[model samples]
Target: MKLLHYTYRKLSLLLLLLMAAWGVLFYYAIIDEVMDETDDTLENYSEILINNALMDPSVLETEGTLMSFYKFRPISEEEAEDYDEKYYDSTVYIESEDEDEPVRVLKTVFRMPDGQYYELELMISILERDDMVEAILWYLGALFLLFLICTSIGTRLILQSVFRPLQRLLDWLQQIQPGKELPVLDNPTKIREFQQLGEAAVDMGNRSYKAYEEQKQFIENASHELQTPLAIVRGKVELLAENESMTEQQLKELDEIYATLGRAVRLNKSLLLLSRIENGQYTETEDVSVDEVLDELLPDLMDIYEGKKIHLVRIKGEEPFVIRCNLSLTQILVSNLVKNSLVHNHAGGELYIETTSSSLIIKNSGEHPLDGEKLFRRFYRSIDGKKDSTGLGLAIARSIAISASLSLTYKWQEGMHLFLLVKESEKKS
Candidate 1:
């Protein structure tokens, strides 16, 4: 979930809990206050009735009424001495409403002018107070609902506005590329924490860009510097080999030196190519078909390795297997993989190439499986090593595939070494 939504959900839950707690407390408080007021009204009516009975004892003979009811009964002296004023709630049958109605009742013991003791009961209706409480609850519920709705809308809008700068920062970060210049971040934020985060991100991008430039420059300079002396050394070795004064042993030594020099030159060139590919030097891209690449590469490869007597098997799907990548790098990637298969194959072995809409599978027959883990590492060679193999071919192929948003994986199955190159999207799916 987005941060704003997560925070809002938590806030909403907290608000709901608080509102519920407040509602419970307020409901009980209002009910208690209403009951207290009813009791006070009953007490006041009892006082008035007692005073009237003392003033004229004949008033006690009257019956109770609806709104205010009273009853007076004679009691023994002992009973009157033990009796005290008390209040309580009770239900009474109402002839008008034909239902039980709630009322507050007060009881007290008093002595008449004749010195005889009597018990008095006073009652007051609380039906109006119950209706008032219901109205209060309805009003409180409506207000709570309104407050919740307003808070939700206001919180969403406020959070969206507050996080706009972070969204802009994310957009800016998405556009950053390895070889491209760092983009200017224009998302201005007043929040101190977000401001610090934006500044740190910009600083990191600047440092990364600087490091990338320096690395690219170093690779180019080193390749250029090394190539010159290597060329001179090979030329001098060739010239020495042509001299007649060299004995048979010296001629063999010179031949070994020349072969070593040639290997060194090839290694240097391979390393330079790998560096250029990784540095994003081959950025020109187009929709290139793998089938077409194999068609052009196979004939030359077969001609070069004609002596191996390797059989070629091509499996083409109905739809073309096309990808968007640098044309030159695509050719190099295919060439290296195909060349590696041919170089490692035994005489009269088979080389299979399968192409589909989403992937390219290359399988070649070999005596044993290569290490899946180390096969793509630079300078990795098989146990049954070939002296002429530079071991950087598969590594370069993997690098090119990755840079072009493709997945290159190797597996050994059924005594055949397989290299599968598929689009990154297909791999994910």
Candidate 2:
């Protein structure tokens, strides 16, 4: 997958491992301390029971009387046995009067002034000790569980907030399109690393967009500066080929060279126009009618339409369709669409150009169908197996439309090819 995907997975894993290690250490440390404290309390209880039993002779016969002197009083006789089994390994006491005997494993001996000796012995069981340990463990486990729940929720919320801006930057980068302005990066990140990442992404996008602007400017300037020189060369070639000494074959070759140069000049001019449109060089915020420009370009299209027996018609709305746009660029857009229809139409075909308040619809009768999606792509030709057409017409028109914030579309319907330019209302001045 992607590096970002791998990085996110590794970060999540690291967090989980760290939390697990922390929980383990905390459980053992805290629970062990608690268990040790409980054991100390039990040891003190054992000593008090032993001292009280030796002090009162009656306590020796009845273990119940020993409860008042014990560190922790047994709740019941049954409980007392279980408690003794948990705490003592074995208990025995030698009478103080019998000072000669050694102190044994679980016994302490006491002797009275009357020469009477009392011995108290008891053994602790593993099961009762395990019960105290288990209690400590359950307390630790519950606390750890609460800590884990809080940390998990906090981690997700923190990560999402930290990565939110980066996600926006990623989405913006993915949506980069030629001839469009970069979108603004709005969300803020406070973490130093994430802030730096966001800054880098914004800088990269801005740099790329600036570079594209510079490249477009260069192409437009180069195309404009080269035009005069190219025309001069074509003129010189024509003048030379007209010399009487040149043979018919020589003149024919000269004519072919002139034709190729003419095509090159046309291509350069179209490319220059497209560059101008993308740069917004031709934009003007003045009211103009789309219908008026078509009136002017239709006559220019007539010469090409002649002898093809094709019909070119214009349908205008009763109300003037006014828009704030560059008249020169709009003319270029409309002219390209009309010329494309004329060039691709079948013999004796009909072409229609209509303008409404909100749109301009151009249609032509033609057998050449194209993938409507690909029609606006630069250098895409509608007709297959056709070598005579320059494929930049639609692309150029689209650039102009986009520069003016207009939407253009293409489709085939009812045996006729269609192109539409949907006008957007002008922004308030």
Candidate 3:
């Protein structure tokens, strides 16, 4: 979840728990105060009745008025010795009202003038008290609910406002690319920590871009510097091969040296191309059809590796796969992949090339699976790879694909090494 929602959820849960606890405590406190008031009223009423009954002996047995709700019972000395005053809630039925009335009851033991002990049971109606308590509970619940909702909404808004700066910084960071200039970050916040974070991010991006340029410049210059010398050495070795006085072993060694020198030259060129691609030096671009590039490269590659007798198979969709990329880079990318397959194939192996409107799949027959993880790393060659192979073909192909906004991936299927290339957008989609 996003940071805002995550924080909001936790805060709301804590608030709910705190409010529930507060509501419980407050509810009991109100109930306690109400009960105390009821008990006090009962105590006063009972005192008045006891005084009247002592003044007039018939008052206890009076049946004409509210006295019907009270009773006086004779008790023995033993019962009077253990008697205690009591107050509680109960209900009484009245035939005139046709309903039960809630009341507060008080019981006490009193001695009459005749030397007889009596127990007085007196009660007062509390129907209004019960209604007040019920009303308090309803309003209390409604108020708590309203308070929680208002606070939750207010808290969410505050959290969103508080985290706006961090969100802006994150958005700015996402738009910063390696070769492209970082976009302007216009986030203006009063917070000190967010300001520092934005400054740090911009500083890091500048330093990274500087380092990337320097690295690419070094690689390009080194590759260019090595080429002429490598060509000169090979030229001198070829001129030496013209001497007739040399023995068979001597010529054989010279050929081996020449072949090794050729691989070095190819490696230097591959590095130069890679450096150029990453530096965005090839600014010229066009809509290039992938199937067209494959068609042009396959003929020459097949002729060059004719001795292998590799069977070629092509599967094409009705619509052609096209991409927007530098023309030279596109050709190089296609050439490297097709050339690699031809050079690596064994005698009588198969080469399968399939194309769709958005993708290309090239599968070359192999004895076993290659290491998919390290297969694209520069100078990563299989154990039984051809001696003349430079090991930079697939690496160059992958680099070009990335530079052209495409994706190149590899897999092994059914004794074939499969290389797939597709536009980055289509691949992601």
Error of 3 at 405 (Å): 4.4
lDDT per prediction? 0.90, 0.69, 0.85
Alpha-carbon RMSD, candidate 1: 4.5
Worst 10 residues of 2 by lDDT: 65-74
Give the TM-scores of the predictions, in the order they appear: 0.77, 0.55, 0.82
Task: Report the poorest 10 consecutive residues by lDDT, candidate 3.
Answer: 60-69
Per-residue error for 218 in candidate 3, Å, reads 1.8
Native-referenced Cα lDDT, model 2: 0.69
Q: 1-429, model 2: which lDDT tens digit per residue?
A: 754556556766776677668767875786566556545654665567666765665555554222122222224334333443333243233355542222112333444446554444433222234565577568756866686677657766676666677787688778776556778777576678867887887798788878888898789689878898889989999898979999999999998888888878988988777777776666456777888887888987878678788887888888656656787777778888888888878789998888887788899997756798888888786544245556788898888777777888888888899998876543222
The reply for model 2, stretches above 4 Å from the true place, is 1-189, 384-388, 424-429
Better TM-score candidate (2, 3): 3
Task: Give the top-scoring candidate (TM-score).
Answer: 3
Total backbone collisions, model 1: 0
